[model samples]
Target: MEAQQKIREQPVDLAILDIMMPGMDGLQLLKSIRGSHHFPVLFLSAKSQDHDKILGLELGADDYIAKPFNPLEVVARVNALLRRVHHFDVPAPPPEPEAKQLVLGALTLDLKECVLYVSGEPVMLTSTEYKILKLMMEEPGRVFTRKRIYEAVWEDFYMYEDNSIMVHISNIREKIERDSKKPEYLKTIRGLGYKINAPAEN
Candidate 1:
């Protein structure tokens, strides 16, 4: 608890914890942190079982390195994961369509934070709204079919529907745009689907 509190108070870029901690144990700590915070965690464990790796990964740990692992290798993997996640922290600008936020002029989509900002105002969104936005925001102006959007948000592919997507989009636009009907941020592509316009690539 002390270590975790310190981590929460300070800006911890990453946390390297041994699976066998003195008091709380690694898995419990990982679960707790994952539930409350979104910090990257690298698990160090002597258990080389595939099950162990799967458990750690399933628990939202950033990396699961076997004990006696090379420090250089661990650092490289951690750095790589950070680069991939951090570099794509914001929405991406699309080159194909006018739906790009970059093209639309001024909209901030913080992908990591799952936040939408228009002229510094916070545009509230739900989990579904944020996921859909993140997918389209990654490539603004790109027309994503309902199937694609469904797959992006939902795990079960067969049960996907367009209505849910539309509803989420409506909810999202209501929060972000001055006029939900004639949206500025989230826009429809007629026969196609929804797009966000240059969102946040970098």
Candidate 2:
């Protein structure tokens, strides 16, 4: 109660939670506060099961670290998350007299506002998904290997977890693509990686 009150009173940039908290579990606390706080929350727990990690991510935790982990690794992960959030939070300089938005097909990405629009309709995206989309949009037609995508967006070394990248890509497509099964913008190059291609002008 005291800790929770302190969190409400203070300006918290991030939260590191243990899954085994007394009275209220971390996931419950996460559900309670996530709607109000947009800051990152990382889970540290002894449960190293894959399902545990997936559940944490699904419940809005930014990153999960299992127990028996090195303290330095935890610090590194915290720093990386903070850096990514800060990078996007910083306001860009005023747009040029004639500002240009990145356009790929019906999708438009406003670099200044860090927002995405599909056919002039706003599309909501999680921070991680937005970074991945931004990277691909910035370099249309270029294939981004899974490793490259992971490192660039997560700001961490890729551990060859293809599932993580695939999940985010699917989420992004569901939001922006009219038909995610047959995506027109984001495409997969079998055995190679993924790329974004601008639709040829009519």
Candidate 3:
């Protein structure tokens, strides 16, 4: 508790915790940590069983090393995790499995920068909006079903709700379209969802 309190008081780059502790088992500790913020967690345990390893990963431990592990390997893994945590250490954009942009309709989305430019005009977008746009840009003119859009955006954190997807598309249209009601860029296909064109040039 004392160690955890001190660590929590400041930013934690990474965490190393033993699986079998006295009061709180490793899994319990992991839950406690996740209750607030997410960070890379490395589990070192004497229990080498595959089930234990699987449970550790399912619980959100980033890397798990079993007991009787080589010190050099543990050190190397720890360093690699640290590099990953710090190098690419940020929650991915709301919808992207990775940071990739799909330029469309005279717009460039620097997903890493989280910046969107439409016809060279800076357009601010929420994470949800960026995700919806990203999908449309990836496949120009291909209608994305509402269910698919919801699954792409909100399925990770909540039940698929088309209302949320519709809202995002509406917002994106307002930002990128010359007349959102007429929507020069993102077009709604009556019963289908929406799509954007990858600008005449990439």
Candidate 4:
């Protein structure tokens, strides 16, 4: 309660939470803060199980670091998360004059505003989800294997983290696809990976 109150009072750029806290667990704190805040949250927990990590991500945590983590690695992850959320890193120049708005079927992605619109209505997406969608939209019709997607968007080495990629993809589909089961734009290539259909000139 006291901690939450302090957080509410101060403007914070990021939050580092521990899962095993006395009285109220970190997950509970996360649930309470998430409603009003959109800042990045990282879980530093001893509960290093895969399910635990998945649960944290599902609950809107930006990243999870297990106990016994190297301090330098933790710092690196934190820096990466901050850079991603703040869009501080410079990207390579595009091949052509990038379109301000990318349209594919009913979906419209505003590259300048970093927002997604479905049928003229805005849709919310997490930073990770937006990054994935942006990558696909940038090069529609290009088959991006899971490894390539993870490496490109995460800017981290791909260690076969399938669940993390799959979960984010599922979330993106829920937001943009009229029927997630019968996705129109984002398509999966079995035995390969995924790709977004080429955007039609608007």
TM-score of every prediction relative to native? 0.46, 0.76, 0.47, 0.78
Residues 11-55, model 1: lDDT tens digits: 655678777888888889877775655446777899877677766
Report the lDDT tens digits of candidate 3 across residue range 64-115.
7778889987786676556544322354545655666667657888757556
For model 2, residues 1-202, the per-residue Cα lDDT tens digits are: 6557877887766789988899888988887665555467789999888887777766667778889999999998898878767534344776677655788888998866667899999775556777889999999999999999988977889875636677667777788877899988888999988999876566
Off by over 4 Å in 3: 1-101, 156-162, 198-202
Model 3 TM-score, all chains together: 0.47
**Candidate 2 global lDDT:** 0.78
lDDT ranking, best first: 2, 4, 3, 1
Please give the ranking of all candidate structures by TM-score, highest first, separated by commas.
Answer: 4, 2, 3, 1
lDDT of 4 by residue, 105-168 (tens): 7778886656789989988666677788989988889999999987777677776454777777
Q: Candidate 2: lDDT of 83?
A: 74
Candidate 2 TM-score over all chains jointly: 0.76
The CA lDDT of each predicted structure is 0.63, 0.78, 0.67, 0.78
